[model samples]
Target chain A: MYIVVAYDVSEDHVRNKVAETLAAYGLQRIQRSVFAGRLPPALVKELAEKLRRVTRGANADVIIIRVDKRALDTAVRIGPALPREGNVHLH
Target chain B: MYIVVAYDVSEDHVRNKVAETLAAYGLQRIQRSVFAGRLPPALVKELAEKLRRVTRGANADVIIIRVDKRALDTAVRIGPALPREGNVHLH
Candidate 1:
């Protein structure tokens, strides 16, 4: 499953923590606050739960969107579409 | 069909115009640079082409993501999930 996580977090520490947690889950930061990657369904659920706990009391809005590969294939890009970090690298 | 249009533009005028064009297409601003909504496949292509033209000479990166309803239904929100604008309104 392909997942996109976007967040608007006010508190600095909490925001960093959220970013760290997401990175730990292997989600790549597409934008400053948006992370997207492929993960198993179970891990996706776990990631959601973890994010929910992190934002329980903070002033933050986080949205997680899951798209299948079929839908993702239809994605269109205009301008610098950077290669995602942590993807397979040729040496 | 659900579509997500995210852009990073360097010019102010072009940025505002991009936003206006996206709003005209009925896509809601989820984040400062991100817009999401439901649009037909044909319109999605048109929007992509229009955005492409607008960003042709500018330093901008725009991505259009199309997802099916089933994929979007799995979306999870943490914190203030605002009611979508221009959606069904009760009078």
Candidate 2:
């Protein structure tokens, strides 16, 4: 299943660290602080746990959202229609 | 512009109340606790502020995400490709 993880991290260092960890697990960056990827249940659980540990005492709030299959399909179809460049058209 | 609002409300009553307020302003429900709609900046700000007030002391956290035009288009295109029925395909 695809997971869309978002975090409101108060510290930039922690955010980068979390992103790096996610990248090691093959997650792709979708936005400034959002990452997306497909993973098995085990991996999802492991990653979530690891993230929580990494943010411990950092005063960061992380939210990992699981996207339903329907939403993932919708995102894929609509993602391409978005402008490929410029902040005005990108989000 | 389109705003995609998501809330993780701990109290069911607060969640429903917030949703009702958003519905009054023309937001359409996209998921169990997520709503999407197009509106002017003034309206979006007003809605967000009002939601904060309604959720005060309710032990709930509300997040109002502003989707770029590109993301909005992506959602629109992919939304149709999603399964029309069943939770398996709907998110």
Candidate 3:
């Protein structure tokens, strides 16, 4: 499954720490404060637990998104059909 | 740009309302509680504003993920090269 996790961290230190942990798990930083990756269910559970521990009391809002296998396939197949300009492609 | 919005709704009624609004904006529901879509920056801001109003005090965590044009293009271009079976593709 493809999962995208986004969080709003109140403290920069805590954000960096959490980002480090996620990077260790092979998550890619895709935006200013968002991360994306593909992981199995067990890995997701583990990552969520670690994140909860590290982000406790940091005043952060975390959202974990799971995109199923089917949607991912649809996206990949349709993506190439979309217009491409510079480096922008929509799937 | 490709954007994914995921939220945890405390109440079922509010969740449905918010989902309805998102669908009206061309966002496709890929999971039970997650929606995916492509939108411009202005549309994203407008959607965020409307989501805040509809989900006020509903005890939900909403995360908006923005994937840059370059990353999106990369994903699209590489997605087909990955393994494919049973409607699952990764980029």
Identify the leading candidate in terms of lDDT: 1
When sorted by lDDT, best at the front, the candidate numbers are 1, 2, 3
**Tens-digit lDDT string for candidate 1 (B1-91):** 7777777788999999899999999987876677788888899889888988888789877777776565555567677555642121111
| Model 2 DockQ (Cα-based) | 0.05
Query: Candidate 1 vs candidate 3: which has greater DockQ?
Result: 1
- DockQ winner among the candidates? 1
Rank by TM-score (best first): 1, 2, 3
Docking class of 3: incorrect
- Assess every candidate by TM-score: 0.78, 0.46, 0.44
**Cα lDDT, model 3, residue A72:** 35
Tell me the whole-model lDDT of each prediction, alpha carbons only: 0.74, 0.60, 0.59
Q: Summing lDDT over every window of 10 consecutive residues in candidate 3 chain B, give the lowest-scoring window.
A: B77-86
What is the C-alpha lDDT profile of model 2 across A1-91, one tens digit per residue?
Answer: 6665655566789878888887887877655555667778789878877886787777555445554444443341111222431112112
Candidate 3: clashing residue pairs, number = 0
Can you write out model 2's per-residue Cα lDDT over B1-91, one digit (the tens) per residue?
A: 5665666666789878988987998987665556667889888778867886888777655545555444443331111223432122112
**Pairs of residues at least 3 apart in sequence or in different chains that clash in candidate 3:** none
Evaluate model 1: give its lDDT. Answer: 0.74
